[model samples]
Target chain A: MNENNSNTNLSSVVSNRAWRQSAPWIAGAAMAAFGLSRRSKSGLALAAAGGALAYAGWRANTSESDQFLARGSVLLNCSPQEAYQRYRNFEDLPKFMFHLESVTKIGERQYRWVALGPVGIPIQWDAEIVDERENEFISWRSLPGSELTAAGSVRFEKAPSGRGTILTAITHFDHPAGKLGYAVAKLFGKVPNFVMQQDLRRFKALIEAGEIATTEGQPHGPRSLKAAALKLADPDRPLARSAPMSEILKQQRRTA
Target chain B: MKAVCWMGTNKMSVENVPDPKILNPRDAIVRITSTCICGSDLHLYNGLIPTMEQGDIMGHEFMGEVVETGSAVQPEKLKVGDRVVVPFTIACGRCFFCQQKLWSCCENSNPNYWIAEKMMGYSPSGLFGYTHMMGGYAGGQAQYARVPFADVGPLKIPQGIPDDKVVFLSDIFPTGYFGAVNCDIKRGDTVAIWGCGPVGQFAIRSAFMLGAERVIAIDRFSYRLEMAEQGGAETINYEEVDDVVQTLKDMTANVGPDSCMDAVGMEAHGDNPMYALDRVKQAFKLETDRPIVLRQCIQACRKGGTVSVPGVYSGFADTIPMGAFMNKGLTMKTGQTHMMNFMQPLLQRIEKGEIDPSFVISHRMPIDSAPQMYKTFRDKQDRCTKVVLDPWATATAA
Candidate 1:
């Protein structure tokens, strides 16, 4: 085997670990297929895709599948201008956006977003609104060399007969080891797509209703035993009224 | 404070937990004086409902003294030290559904909307002490409970009324009233209702109040049937009858009652082939609901008559006899109780001594007895039709 082909195999295996799990068992079958066929890189890629998503015992590295492309839309009982303005202000995002710790406005149409990463690490990116149309649409993307790559657009359309505003948001982001981000957030029962949908709902609530509804810091029974042993982020863990990840861990530690 | 926690399926225990505090701007802390075990709580105890995690608090029918109020709560709406009966359905008063008086369908109160949206297409309002799918708000079966959207869902009780007379304003009374109201009972209308639980008992009396000439109540338990009889219902013990549908038809001059109600929901009991089928399916999680009563209600109703279901159906029900439902051209009305809508009017009814809501209570136990009480209630032991739990009662009170 040549060094180049071996290197290609290594990266291909690492890039799709979710599917390429059971690698050792499947490697034999793949090697057998390779021997039967004329040498072709495309055949190797096909073999990996056909593998099952069984977790490999020797687990390491993150797969690109772990990333998220959150697309959600919600109807708000308000004017398009109100909906657009409520979403346009970056600083108010943490109130509704579950994943964001804070979005600080640094320059005109520019903002810095801090989000939680694996094991208390903070992932941040600077972003600026690229273009905007009053009460209609706005588009934005992350700056170069940021820890995360994100691009998104939001559109507000007035429903017929003056009913309300239809707000739609489409966002795609690739965080470093994004799988860990999903796993951590999911521990609190918030998936990325669900988070985006809830964020849109929260946005609607905040726009039409003055405050978002939640049950944060309520009391429950046998909490200490559950809090100390399994340390499970219980299902009753309230909405993301507080920030995510490290902050939640700190609270759990204090209670534990 | 001592609170009841769900350890697992069929396991409940009272434990010490911190006192509840205001969690939102419209929130209030209620020191629970009276809380009740509902028939629907059996759904949680039997593990028929999903999204119930271990250690989740239980109980929803409760009334208490408001110990603290949040800044956003207007004094005219609610104040500290006020006696209030809390509704189980949480709603933000500004939302579209709340404005339309469909408080149970409020969109914002459920923090876990996405979970519900997946199952229900559109989620309803959050419920206290229910499951996470219903917003996972810690429930009121404790010493002190946090109530969100406080100004909207709680009704102030005048000082003179006893807790037993008014605690049911939280759910069953409104639910039964809604059931009767949905029946659209005209003068001399005849109504047949399935189930004789607390809700069914209230629905029976409410039907009479709404001018129904005759009310037929169906159940297997004689005690429940006797209670239904006391509410002016003609009893049909389903176990003694060979064929309930035919019996109802024969009794009603070969034409069914004008309206039929299903107060017994997802988990129904019967000695029939369909009941066994539904039970087998339910055991395997193949179907989330047992439509035995729903099916009978549809099959037994007169042609073109209305069917009112106040029963709680969580998910998909199999073999619903839709052909009968559609061919008969029946009108059906069903939903969770919009508590804010019926609460105040019913409070006046109770105050007037029109109908005492407390007649449904057959057991009154201290909070610590809740663990054993759950089993007694589920098993229907000790003629336990309904249990009212006193949070402050000492262990040896009995």
Candidate 2:
């Protein structure tokens, strides 16, 4: 309960993406405006403190923020019952969610999750399943005061003609709308919608097939520097593709 | 262990990398004896495919001795010291696609499914040393390499059958067979094929084996044309002939062949303006594939006939004659060869003396010469059809 109050206080201060960047300047400008109105020394100081606190509270609460929601859905060729049964096992999340390193079932309804945040930073938190509607719906939220604040839910529904199950996942982060790939930007060259969609893809693969397909531990050549460079370059490419073939050939020959 | 690594486009190197160990439960470590540079690998060399990172080990067609086996690899399926030919396409035997004999379409194989799904809707099976879009598993160009889904994909070779006899089962021979099978041959039906590369050579023989009445093979190189002719195909030097499609039509009495197969894919060569445009567009990243051969195959195919593509197309192609394809009521059949489905049957054919897949090999070199061999194969140097690499061979052999 105390944690929840601290979260509310911190969120009001840290909620706005614009505020995080521009708050100091905004506070200074407001202080200058208040200074001009004060006639005495103590009066100005007290008024300055009060005004600063009040404006911060007002701006933090009033700014449009923290409604960042990420979502994706996939059509899995399996029954909803099987899909639900498999997904609710939080430990298996690492199998599909690429950035998610591990999820440990701590209690009947709770899980301790460790995930790689932006730039592959390890961020761990505790979350609990808040709601369930057997074979149809499940929801979870991170505990109060966690470094990364997020809530997520999943839904499973049977499709027509016995085709399969439709699985939808939604995650809401304590971030502004523009930073859609905020948390997972580094691991997937900025991923949130795409990552969630890929997560659901692996979940679909896992349900229809017996294993989550992966090449994580497989061998490749010594490509330490190039992989990192490619990750950095992906977001800047004008088109979706890169390195034209003919240019690549000419470049290779020149280098060779 | 020394392995062939693709450092960049058109760049291949033999690097001493650490030996591979079993990565998955069904994985096996193959001490590679013979691995070949595939024509499809040229697609990668030319940077036509996406998701290939620098320093990715390169080679998909290989045969070797099993040195180690994962815990889940059953003794009945595979064991240490077993001589085996590993199929390029990885498959989990339990997948729905694998159970139905669509081994190349096995959903459980590709780990990087999302990348492929972004391009091809659904990913097919993972392939060794291909691209990350196709599972990006380290290829068998190395001396010792990992083989995943080992129980499902590797076929054991008997002692009497030499590595040369059965090694092609790993990819091209079966791939060529699959291309021929794609033709849906009615016995005595004439089938026209484009590009008489190694796979095309195999396709020529496979077409005859599948009862093709007459096989028309097209390519510019004489050595390749000679090999296809040796395979009992009536060859055409596409560069020598003006309007090769018309020549094909005239040869077929203006009716065209019953089936047309494009053994060439993205990097198709032609002596025309359309081909030049394809190169420029591909160079400028305007189109991802040069589909000149494909256009010809579709144009030259008889009405209601099938166009079979055994070649690899990485991404988009422009100016395909869809009007010719659709208005003529033609059908198209193509896929990465479901390698496991054909490896065993083709191996049996080799055992029975019906076919010696080794006839396709024009050069045998040590792995260290891979960088030059890649160029040799790419440029068709010294009449190179297919070059087999012995990973164990030392530098002096070159």
Candidate 3:
């Protein structure tokens, strides 16, 4: 009996879509031909309706390709200038993106990112900012010869209260191996999205919670001792003062 | 000739493989009598850990009799028939890192050079049968194993204690003690541990031994929770509780657990009630999450508290809230277990009968039946907490 029931169940499952699709007319004909039990007929009607709803839901939710969309907003209780100053520097990427090794500015509008990829793989990507509205929005697209290329955008908007700005980011990526890649992405893509969202939140917190350090008085690459001395001697004048080191030392000593 | 080989996930079998000959002067052949599967071994069985070639011999936690010694080995201190427990970590004591007590990062010890480079070039200390990254040394799961760095790695199992009782001292015991030590728990501090797995359970017990005022155990498993309670911990079933952090805060007078240890490593399951998805993201790598617990521990600890992290962690990339950590003024210390450093103190504690870690062992079977036991333990069936495999037992006896 169990074996027969299992066989029937398997057959029904195999024919489920066809049965549901043709159920309305078939049920009406069955009701007319044979006085079917009211309960069984009602049960079949419910099953058909439920299956149709489920299929619709699945179709709406499931994407054919591995495409994922995640949205996150953070209220930074600070000015847009403060947020921009904190985030504009590429060196600050590590504070938010944990896996990022470093971000190097290739050009005024382009940057290169190196990060530890999934399963210990090293991944590198070059990105150019396509759209940039100062302290409002920044959008970037992956350059050629990039591993796991993707497009993403970050937008800052004045909050309703006017006390803070809301930061939002959107990203899209293509899986590595097509359908199989999509399946794997479907399995684990949510993890990266979640991580990215958390990183953004951390970035918001960091920007809002600090006094922006000025680039002034900070060392800019390597400078010779003489160049440093000249800069220190005249803040306003651009290194026009030239004097021998011995003469300068003697003059300073004599004045003392 | 016997060696344990992985057939598949949670499927291990003992087969007559070629006998190991002494390949180096530093090598010593041990006739294994007591060897057990570790919690980390489950990572291999579940296929979460990668780069495991099939037919790898599979035990790291072991104790054995010295059946043969290599030519250059000083046989004076270790002779034939001497019973000893080999640490899960193997270090060439003379290496640069080893001299500084950084055994886990010894240059000569780690077998997986490529993996080491990927994980910041820090070598994962040599371990028995853990994989190529862990030195690929055949583990004690078989009848015989070639033990390298025998003088520095193997500890003579002291007399009078049952082999089963002291077997855990080699790995789980020191690991647990190390957790407590790492947390920097003081004489009167409240500690909370996530996951009552073997290591976590030992962490709780060791916390009490280290003089903790209270130990809160959090887990979904009732049996493990009960074990925690028996070990003098206040149990928190995360499944029954909704707000874990809030509940813990309420319990600890608005301060979170002074010290928190996450024994649940990287292959974390979502079904676990105490599982923090946010924390997992912050502590992505297996090695980093152990330290991530320190982040939460920092939030929960009192001002000026110290967080100790004894859980094993590796990998280069980990996201931690450095701003929060610095703001909280929390101090943390963590590294691989200097098992040799912690052994004498733990042995002294065992000798005084002040601690009984052996009670954590729930199952004992012969080496041949390990495959089934691995499945049971992996699935956490029958509330199996810890399983010890007796290598000398016949297949039928198991």
TM-scores for all predictions: 0.84, 0.81, 0.57
Q: Write candidate 1's Cα lDDT for B305-340 as tens digits.
A: 889999999888999889999999888999999888
> Which sections of candidate 3 miss by over 4 Å?
A1-256, B270-299, B314-323
lDDT score at residue A111, model 2, on the 0-100 scale: 88
Point out the worst 10-residue segment of candidate 3 chain B by lDDT. Answer: B282-291
Give the alpha carbon lDDT tens digit for every residue of A132-251 in model 3. 678887767678777556556677777785556777765545444533343324222433344455566457534532211111221112334654665455331122112121221221
> Global CA lDDT of candidate 1, please?
0.78
* Model 3, docking class: incorrect
Assign candidate 1 its CAPRI class. acceptable
Interface RMSD of 1: 6.9
- Badly placed stretches (over 4 Å) of model 2 are A1-64, A74-82, A98-130, A141-150, A158-165, A176-190, A204-212, A217-219, A222-256
Ranking under DockQ, best-scoring first?
1, 2, 3
Ranking by TM-score: 1, 2, 3
Write model 1 residue lDDT over A93-134, tens digit each, in one string. 888876578999988888999865434556678998877789
TM-score (C-alpha, index-matched) for candidate 1? 0.84
